[model samples]
Target: MNDVESPIDLRNLKDALEWQETANVKRPWRKDFFDYYVDLIRPRSSDQCQILELGSGPGFLTQHLLSQLPNIEYTAFDFSAVMHQLAQEKLHASEKTRATYVVGSFKDAHWQNTLSQKYDFIIIHQALHELRHKRYAIEFHKTIRSLLKPNGCYLVCDHLCAPHAMQNDQLYMNKQEHLQALQQAAFKQIKIPLEIQGLCLFEMNVI
Candidate 1:
């Protein structure tokens, strides 16, 4: 069903599930990425850490994050209506979990302004390159730095697509570009051998 006639149809709930089902084999990458983040971010002496996961489709990565940091709170957000609904259903099943799901376009959402809370960690998985503006990524990076505590961390992971394939109008940030943006936003990149959903990890701290 995901291989529908139109791209719009592929964005539907059924297609989203189908796509996820097909991509299930890639969970190892996602797992590795999250593990790297958890290890690096090991919140020091904090009992109530918070995480903001961007593009939290179906809450797969979000669930793992929550399990790792049992006392931590989570705010999972996604742009797609179908994925947002799925995230709500998935997150709602947890009775004791302190997780919130928001349905809004990540491209231009007032997440920090509306929430008014800083996070110990912010994770962006398989979602960076989808942004249409490189400046947006930079702005978002700056936003994260501003919203993170002095010792807080941010993790961004995305597919290592063929270099040539990133030539489209939409600015798909390269690995170096990502690092530069993070650094410009006053973040320090920490090298780690991490992978997730075919993405390599770029962990940074807002020191």
Candidate 2:
């Protein structure tokens, strides 16, 4: 969290996770993002359900999710080893459920095979738009649907892009395109309460 430089790639994800003191500061608004996100999904998903979080930073919310839900199974994937170590320490310290952490990109070909089971609920908090390219985007959804056990819950919350590109290009998909893409993949979308910073949450039933 010092004045560390961002890694060339997500190799910094672990660093970001390990040194989250800076993350909360860098993105002060994300605290509210997590607050709104947890409030939206925690009550609906029981402990009996299986949940997966893609691009989890340090499992802070992962810890919260486990404690709030009933006998739940948790598997979180992050491409950062630093994050894996930090997450392990935090999760164990909290005495939360033993979480499965896989270290690799979401677009990796071996995901569905390694992940094995479909989730009852999948939450992507603030990490949806980081996915790289168009082909990878298509694969991302295909893999997401594969992880669903029929009508599984897909909760997504991400940035609201400005109408102009070059300036507000952090957003990978426009708000409307994001919705349309989900619908195209057969998700029944319902808009949930939004928080400050244009953070939107969608609860989609994977039918």
Candidate 3:
């Protein structure tokens, strides 16, 4: 989706389902890591306040977040329909009403046509690395900047790797690379306030 492209196949429904189980097995560490992102969320002014989660998988983190911040409206987007189905199953009946699930890629040609509103917060967890093209990292942050409300937060929790390291099926960028990409997207007040294990958490604001 950026000026430089790499061909990679996205995960299908079957792979998506399997990945959920794997993430579950690491829930103890994963939950704490994910919680770091949620902890920084500011409470919204209304019950209808919105949150957008990109690459949401089976609602693991979303359900955990809803428990902490119960009233806000939420939208979960993932490329796999099976992930949405699995997320629905994981969320409580009452909590389900607060969420809307969409199946699509943020980098898709039609992505901009689907989103109609900006969000108070946009969160991504460990999914960025799966992007086939590293250059899309820059483009996707630009997309995110436009989707955020003024002064809203964009939080990303992902693994860091050597700058030149190559990983198939993933876009691994070192800290400097990440900063450069986010800055190029015009996000302000950028900071990496937390790091746990190999995961680095980025907090940037739309000004």
Candidate 4:
């Protein structure tokens, strides 16, 4: 967690696995907080719904979501192969399972060209802060907008940079920073209903 000039390489199997385990053990509140947000925004009906989870490390977010809304389709996308493998192992096979796991990053040169389907809910939890730079974060917000259906919603929960914090490789955006990016991406009805433990939860509509 030192102030390195680049993002951490989470592609390593050992490191990725260890990071997931350590976060679970050390940050129990993190799970509870995220679960609360997921429950607040989960689908309301048994009707089929499409969801896309970005940076789904170890499937923790997806699992919490499915536990609440068991009848929806879930797709997970992550850049790390090891993390994706871990997520696959942790997720169970169920009759309600309509899941797709893709090992790719939006940062890739032709990543948007690879995805065809849009989603009703696009989730990014605890991952946007690792975007490496502010510009990438803004671009990602735009990308998420493009991936959502007309009435789709996007959810984001991540650390917020303290005001006056010096610029570094690690990406952390405060409320205003995120608001600017989301506005530029054309997201409407943006809400930041919760901010605790130096993290914030955001929900916005694509329309």
Candidate 5:
């Protein structure tokens, strides 16, 4: 599928909310994905670890992370205003205090400029494909690496395209392609800690 073939228009308030609801029903294992993230980040739970989430649509993962890690500070970065709105509505008032929401698109390399602080953890869940093609993955990963603190972890979870899996080559990368991009971006200690429901979760550290 091409960029125009993207399934949802997150810019619209109605569309964004509807997509959020639909995603809940479609990806029951989403919580499992969130749990894996929690485990990976549990080591930093006691500290005021800074975290940034790229394409943090509607803050589902943000809410889960904040609830699990009370000491962590989170930045929810998304391009769509409606998405941030939905996320703000979903989060508790207490959770909102520790969270900062920013609106920006990763489609542009300059999107990194919007964030001033480096993070202990940088994450993206099922959203990198929104860059519209796998060709952009490496550059995007490089930007993510730059935003990370020394030895920071980048947790990427996204749909995969393989002969036996989702076949949208233009939108999703196969496992090998994903690994190659991370390696080319100079991410070290890369590991595929989880792959479930057609999604792969890659855990890697900044060089």
Candidate 6:
């Protein structure tokens, strides 16, 4: 697949909602991905962990996480206001209290400044490639690393471009390139907890 601009404008409410429905139907494995995240986070369920989700989209994962981990404080950061609205609508009144919605594009250098506090877990699922190009991966990973608290983990799952099922190199990288970016960002430890279909998930820590 070649690099192409997104056809749907997530900033539009109708488009955002349509995208949410389509994605859920087209990708059955998304539920599996969500469950995997919940399993990884289950270990920290007792603590009041701070979780930041980059490109949180329509809050499918946010709803899953908040419902599964009651004590976590979540910040859903996305660039589109309509996406934020859609996410908020999915959440209950109580979940809304525990979750904060922030609108900012990670493509901008100053995006990190919008967040006041560091997070125990920074997550991005099927969203990192929204940076629009692979060249920006390393610097973005560095920025994500800086936002993490001591002993915090960055959990990222994104599409990969590989020999068997190649994607646009400008938009997606292979597994090795993904690991290299995390390592170059100075993550002391990194592990690949999952890799299925076209997606790979990395669990990274600085300590």
Please tell me which predicted candidate would have the highest lDDT against the true structure: 5
Per-model TM-score, in order, reads 0.79, 0.79, 0.86, 0.87, 0.95, 0.94
lDDT of 3 at 202: 89
lDDT of each: 0.66, 0.66, 0.76, 0.75, 0.89, 0.88
Give residue 132's lDDT in candidate 1 (0 to 100): 51
- The better-scoring model by TM-score among 1 and 6 is 6
Candidate 1 lands at a TM-score of 0.79
Indicate the worst ten consecutive residues by lDDT in candidate 6. 1-10
Q: Model 4: per-residue lDDT, tens digit, 24-131? A: 676566776666655665544367788888888877877777776776788888988888777767666772366788888766766766667998888888888656
For candidate 4, the C-alpha RMSD (Å) to the true structure equals 3.2
- Per residue, candidate 6 scores C-alpha lDDT tens digits across 100-150 of 999999988789999999998999999988988888888999898789999
What is the per-residue lDDT of model 5 for residues 40-138, given as tens digits with 9 covering 90 to 100?
888976878999999999989999999999899999999999899989887888999999999999997698999999999999998989898888899
Per-residue lDDT over 1-207 for candidate 2, one digit per residue giving the tens place of the 0 to 100 score: 122233345467544644566756655776666666556566656546678888887777677666655566788888777776676777654445547887877756766676878888788887776564322454576578888887687777766654433124433566676777776676665666564456566677765
**Which pairs in model 2 have colliding backbones?**
14-83, 47-70, 47-71
Worst 10 residues of 1 by lDDT: 1-10
Q: Candidate 4: what lDDT? A: 0.75
Worst lDDT run of 10 residues, candidate 4, spans 163-172
- Evaluated at residue 149, the lDDT of candidate 5 is 92
Per-residue accuracy of model 3 over 3-45 as CA lDDT, tens digit each: 4343433356677666776875753477776667556663463
Better of 2 and 5 by TM-score: 5
| Residue-level error in angstroms, candidate 1, position 129 | 1.5
Cα RMSD for candidates in order: 4.8, 5.1, 3.4, 3.2, 1.5, 2.1
